[model samples]
Target: MTDPAKHAVLYRMVMPEHVCPWGLKARHLLRSKGFTVDDHWLETREANDAFKAEHGVKTTPQVFIDGVRVGGYEDLRRHLGLKAPDPQAKTYGPVLAVFAVTALMALAVSHAAFGSALTFRALEWFIGLSMMALAMLKLQNLETFSTMFLNYDLLAKRWIPYGKVYPFAELGAGALMVAGVLTWLSAPVALFIGGVGAISVFKAVYLDKRELKCACVGGSGNVPLGFLSLTENLMMIAMAVWMGVMALQHG
Candidate 1:
């Protein structure tokens, strides 16, 4: 048993219909941290409201240590040094999710169009859709994306306006490739940008040994600038070359 001075009091809402998850987490956190928790549950809405009014706080589960209020779950986490300062800290989750969803969509489209799930056409569709999706993320906030891009992009760092135009170029090429039209335009655009992007990413990550977030998905994305970024550029370059060769063969 911990000393009385190390006791934590937690008040959380628990009803037949609703149970506050944060309260449970707070209690667990306190218990894990070797604190003896005096847990109190507010069973009714009126009781919960009254408890909030009494404490001068709006949200549950509130924690108290040594007769001092420690706020809610997030606040408690902060007090315990378990919460990161930035809530939107960098993570590869957004980029991974975008790729996974777009790949599935490409497969579905391929199945519908050519009646085959595993085909070269599916790969083409996947690459095209991935580019468009990534471009869309950048287009969400061009200013932010451009700013982040300028951090490591060699060309963008030199010509500031290139960062602003990059997303549109990617989007245009992706759309054209997906439609199997305007290969003459799409191929050259994809090739040029993809070539530049590959070199920039390689130099920044491998040569200069700079660790930075990728601006591939969006300016605010937490995707790291490394292999995945390189792979994306390589995919674009390969697709452009393939499309150009096919066009020449047919012409």
Candidate 2:
């Protein structure tokens, strides 16, 4: 049986090029909460603008309950006793997700190669894969990454080209290390960047007490510049040293 009393009027953008995601979310939320939604689409920019002006609101995807304005998506959420996501909240979700995926990949590779998931090779692969994945993220938008990198990276601040070259170097080093070849080159590359990055992170976050976004996960600007960033660099440094020793022993 449908709840006749629970009715919501939703004004949302539905254009040729773009549809309002929030509006979709609002409708879904309304339906999930046992409300019948009367969806109204502002199909054109002019209509959207006119609706905004008529309603004296800045954004679309407005909702009304029982002929009274419930406001936009966030307001509807609040009206429905739900919490809305804060955009400015600092979260390690991206880094944690990256690490989790890389770790799984490492275990998978180790199992495929050594017939055992729990092996020393898994650790090596985890770090190498993490580096490569992070590098790929930065390479997706080099300019954006570099601009964010300059914020806390001491070397990047001084030498702008280093920021641009960093992703390529990381990718090369990670690929070589993962392949277990050219350790002579990969080890040094990893060590140099890791050393510089560790120092920069330590100075900026701890010494200067600066709260900044880490470029480790590229320029999306979610991960905080702190311990995790330092830990990432330290892992590279340790891996570099370990590989360097192994290379020397074999030679």
Candidate 3:
């Protein structure tokens, strides 16, 4: 008798116009798990449909191990005791990455300029750099970001042009703040936009209880609107206030 554990069969779609990604993943996963895959391709839509009907399965990329049907890519993962990704789970990876990189950048700049990494300037740079990074994400596709921003931003909804201007304003303010220059200009711009954004995020997520995607990372991300979104705006607000006070004390 042959050992069935070492052998697996996979049926996946391979049409001329497109190929199923899950099918490729299933094959790779099976190979990585030390199983020899007997790959079978359903090259046509008709064949795919017929195979699905015959197997009584709605989706393709079906895997069979040792004559036992193990189902599709997700099912194969479960059978192999692997953790599959959950589509509904919210992730803060983008924001976390931005914060982490900006924090490092702040320390580097502080050490270079002030001969110290843990100075007051480092905190300001961290916030400023983070703001710039976030603005860059939105600026990647201004139209898309503006469209999504309108969904929950109060000022953007009231004045449509504000959505279009937001990325530029954020980028400009962040750049100026990081340079520690033009405090008179950057402080007010940061204050106004941050104040408005904080209120809008608060109303949308808390008061109205609406489930919305954050436009912070980009228009095309799945990051849910919640605490991080509010925190971003709040940081800008706090930075603006602190900068304004410093400018006043110096003047």
Candidate 4:
């Protein structure tokens, strides 16, 4: 095991189900700092409320750094004096080119799949909607993109740390491609990630696995998972890439 100071961090006073982003952020931040963090995200709602009431921190994300209390997002930002990712064109050059290529490739694939349909068929609609759902799930919070690892859902539901490599890289790369909100980064990351998700949906449908939760994000209601999910992921991947690229170029 690595030295604690070299690679050990701990998060205490956590609430499991009530929120996911705060602890998530702490973990990601530690990873950025080259530390391995142990997260404690379990607290009773009543207990959580009592603590919050006492501290005058009415929400989740009350953080403690090295056992010293750090404030919530605003406080953390103030403390760190963090600079947001440069939205300026100078910093995101490669990202712009990648997204442009991705957008074109996606269009080609989409046309091939649908044969220039002005009105999409039911299968097409389902696929489109599913993509939106998955994309939105992560997009709902910017914190998701900042994760330092991936979960190998087919193998283990636990997060596979980014350090393990490959599939994790794919997951992170794919997530950024699909889920990033920044214009330059979001599109390519979305394209790659959404494309992967599309493929997964199709493969699952091909294998006839229908009972599982689709795990698609927003606007997915009782939708049959399978072809619809695949189509949706693929389509959004393209759009996200375009938006990201556009955002970068004009900056």
Candidate 5:
């Protein structure tokens, strides 16, 4: 009889958030072992039917080796003899762990360049950690570098959301960074946030001489207008660039 394992296949189904974190290891190992791995991926709900029919299963990350139904992601790892890393292990534990380290790096870069090392100022020091926020801040600050973008009338009229625009951009980047940590799109989110933050910061420095009022975010009077403000924005820009570089390295 022919060996069924000779023509084995590997299958992976990725959905909103149920993808196997270690699936890459199994696939790579199989390829390295001179196995004719018939690997297939189903990324949509519509593709589930065909996979379910073939595997007699209706769940994601279904694993089959030599046409024998093993199980989901875990079974696939087992079939391929891929050992699972400890959940509590610190090194190479999760993909998010890498991003988390990048986030820390961005914050560290910002702090090393500016701001006091106070705990209350920690958030401020780490503000540029996310790529999206950094880029946005840079772009927004490029012109006038402050609530200076908004006229006094608009500030008084409570149209501050559109007045400064940098904060809104920062807010969006921050949200993306926070969300990225919890989702598979962490790299993309970080890239975008870092880009925005960097843009705002770079702009602030580039347009250092422009005079602008500090309506603050939501009239909060947080981000001031001046060379210091420009310095602040650049700090964020550097952070974004760092994050983008990190993502590219990981990818």
Candidate 6:
């Protein structure tokens, strides 16, 4: 008696010009799941076309378990009780990745420029890098970002143009802060926007009790619009005030 679970047949495209990645993935998946794969490589375009036509399927990398057809790579994943990866799935991973990388870069740059890593300047660099990274995400798709921003932003709700300019303003302030130059421009912009953002987030989440996504990362982000949003605004405010005080004292 042959066990159906132990055997799989994979029909994948493999040619001189190109090899299908999904086909390779299918083979790997089958092997990982303890299936002995009978891999069939269609060596040419004509062979691939003939196989698809004979099987009455549109695409290659088709799988079969115990002589029962299991369709393509996605179908195989379903058969194995694995959810296909969704690119549009809302997650904080993108924002978290950006912040983590930017923080490391900031620390590295700070260490290189200054003799120590633990300085007020390092904090400024972290904040600046974080802001620039966030702005870059927003600027990727301004239309989508603005729509998300207007959902909870007080100023954006009142003035539609504010959403469009927000990313540019953030980028400018962050750049100036990173350079340790143009405190006059950076401080005021950061102060005003950060204050507004903090109040808006507080009102929306704490007062109104509205549960929403944060646009701090991007339009399609899944980061919650509460503590993280508040923290970002507060950080901006602190940076602005610190820079302002330093500027006054240095004069």
| Best candidate according to lDDT | 3
Name every residue pair that clashes in candidate 1.
none
Model 2 agreement with the true structure over 1-251: per-residue lDDT tens digits: 34778998999999999999999999999999989889999999999999999999999999999999999999999998999888988888888888999999999989999999999989999999999999999998999999999998889899999999999999999999999999989999999999999999999998999999999989985889999888889988999999999889999
Model 6, residue 60: C-alpha shift (Å): 6.0
Minimum summed lDDT over a 10-residue window in model 4 is located at: 148-157
Candidate 1 residue lDDT tens string, 24-83: 989988888889999999999999999999989888889998899999998998998896
Write the residue-wise lDDT of candidate 4 on 3-108 in tens digits: 4674433433455545556566756665675555555554677766776787787676566666666666445556466743433323223323334444554455
Task: Please tell me which model should have the higher TM-score, number 2 or number 6.
Answer: 2
Order the numbered candidates by TM-score, best leading.
2, 3, 6, 1, 4, 5
Write down the RMSD of all candidates, one decimal each: 6.4, 1.9, 3.5, 19.6, 17.9, 4.0
lDDT of 1 at 95: 71
In candidate 6, which residue pairs get closer than 3 Å at backbone N, Cα or C atoms, i.e. clash? none
- lDDT, candidate 3, residue 205? 95
Positional deviation of 157 in candidate 2, in angstroms?
A: 2.9
Model 3 agreement with the true structure over 91-185: per-residue lDDT tens digits: 88889999999999999999999999999999999999999999999999999999999999999999999998998999999999999999999
Report the lDDT tens digits of candidate 5 across residue range 125-202: 354343343334445454454444444322313544543454555555555443334223433443443354344434
Candidate 4: C-alpha RMSD after superposition: 19.6
TM-score, every prediction: 0.73, 0.92, 0.81, 0.31, 0.29, 0.79
For all candidates in order, the CA lDDT equals 0.91, 0.93, 0.94, 0.47, 0.48, 0.89
The residue pairs that clash in candidate 2, if any, are none
Two-way TM-score contest, 2 vs 5, winner: 2
Of the two candidates 3 and 4, the one with more favorable lDDT, higher being better, is 3
Kindly provide the TM-score of model 2 when superposed on the true structure, using C-alpha atoms: 0.92
- lDDT measured at residue 3 in model 3 versus the true structure, 0 to 100: 40
C-alpha positional error of residue 58 in candidate 6 after TM-score superposition, expressed in Å: 8.1
